[model samples]
Target chain A: MDTALSIGSAICLLLGSFLCLTGGIGILRFPDFYTRMHAVSVSETSAAGMILIGLMLQSPDGIVVIKLVMILLMVLFISPASSHALAQSAMRHGLKPWLSTTVPAIKNKHNETASDITSDKGVPPSNL
Target chain B: MIHTLYLSLTLAAFWLLNSGHYSPLILSLGAISIAFVVYLAHKMDVVDHEAQPVHLTLKLPGYYFWLTQQIILANISVVKHIWLGNKTITPTMTTVKSSQKTDMGKVIYANSITLTPGTIAVDLIGDQIIVHSLLSENIEALKAGEMDRRVRQLEH
Candidate 1:
């Protein structure tokens, strides 16, 4: 039972860590600030949740479980509020969203032509 | 009065769970702190249904479970799109109408949208929520009003 619990907890933690990595890559790769913030919510929700549940599973007793749960509750409640405020403020500040149409050059199939078009246009936002 | 009792018990339990140190001095200190906070809340006249939300205590767990499942599914979809890279990440904004009557209900609905991966509520202007989604499909889902309906159910 102990070994099973340990393995389960370990798997949860590893999955949590992988989710965090995905969120990190997403933040770097996603276009524009709003989408990046969307990526961040992934980190805040699923990644944070996975880690907290793993910890809760490892916690010894009732009080420890309660403490972990309370922390998770706090994160779940606070994260979205903070992220909403962040996106609202960014929108309020007149930042234009990088929508699909804002990026014009991704559909180009020819690699050399895409690179050539990108040269004077000062780099496409990211790769094709 | 009921809110006060519920709040105090919750506070005490939270303190006990958090403190993890149950000596006389620490316990008394924790009690004193809880008393002071509750007193402050009472003085501020904010300990009513909106503040305590004891009614929501039961409704929330069900909503949370559903939201968690959605979060996982959305997370997998988000990870897939991330690996697919930017072209497929068609970021779009849409405004969805919230039929929730109360402020708390609306806030919960908006937060649920923001909490889910691939979507974030950018602004809550009156009854309309301005949402930015990573995919066009997510926008359509938001337009479908499933989450909005769930939150309204919680409100009832």
Candidate 2:
């Protein structure tokens, strides 16, 4: 039984590590902020959960289980909220979704800098 | 009324559990630390009606477990896509309305959406949320109303 439990824990750890690896890759390969954020969620929630579960299984003690559960709860509550806040802040600042062809732009915080907010007004470059 | 006690007790328990050995010295130190922190919090006027709703806290575990499952599935999908080098990626932006009534509920709803792989909540336009998805399916999933429903349940 102990051996089986150890094997189970190892398997869980491997799976969790793999998921985390993929999440990192997705964050890099995906085209936009939103997609990257999605990748981060996968890494933060699933991989962490699996690892925690694996640890819990190895321990088999009530207190250990409770601690693991608490950690999981903390992660679940914080990770998503942080991601949402970041995304919302980005959008509020008028970050545009990337376009395949045009590389959609957003108006720079100042007109003088490279404009990120794409507008077709053909406004002349301001010296400011 | 109960939240402060709960938080303090939790803190003390956590301290003891983490400190590894149970002894009178450690126990006294832990008690002092917890009391000091709680007292400071009280003096700062940080504990009051705005405290997180304890009733809603019960569903926290469920939300976490569900979210973990989704994350795993999402990781597998994303990894497969990368390995295949498939150009199957479909990026799109969409909007959805949140069903949550309270400020905390809305925050949770938005956070949950961002937590899922392939979907990110970009903006809050009043009750409506602007989200970007890596695939049309992700957007459809949001439309399916699961996230909104789960967040609503937490509010109760």
Interface RMSD of each: 5.5, 4.6
What docking tier does model 1 reach? acceptable
* Residue A87 Cα positional deviation in candidate 1, in Å, after optimal superposition: 0.4
After superposition, the stretches of candidate 1 with alpha carbons farther than 4 Å from their true spots are: A102-128
* Per-residue C-alpha lDDT of model 2 across residues A45-95, encoded as one tens digit per residue: 778988998898799577788788889878977886788788777766765
lDDT of each: 0.82, 0.71
Over A39-78, each residue of candidate 1 has an lDDT whose tens digit, in order, gives 7888888888899989988888988888788888899889
How far in Å is the alpha carbon of B101 misplaced in model 1?
A: 1.0
Per-residue lDDT tens digits for candidate 2, residues B16-76, read 7667668899788888999998999888887654563667667888987796677657667
Per-residue accuracy of model 1 over B13-94 as CA lDDT, tens digit each: 8888788888999999999999999999999999999888988998888988898899889989998888888877777665
TM-score of chain A of 2: 0.73
DockQ scores of all models, one per candidate: 0.38, 0.33
Each model's TM-score, in the order given? 0.87, 0.78
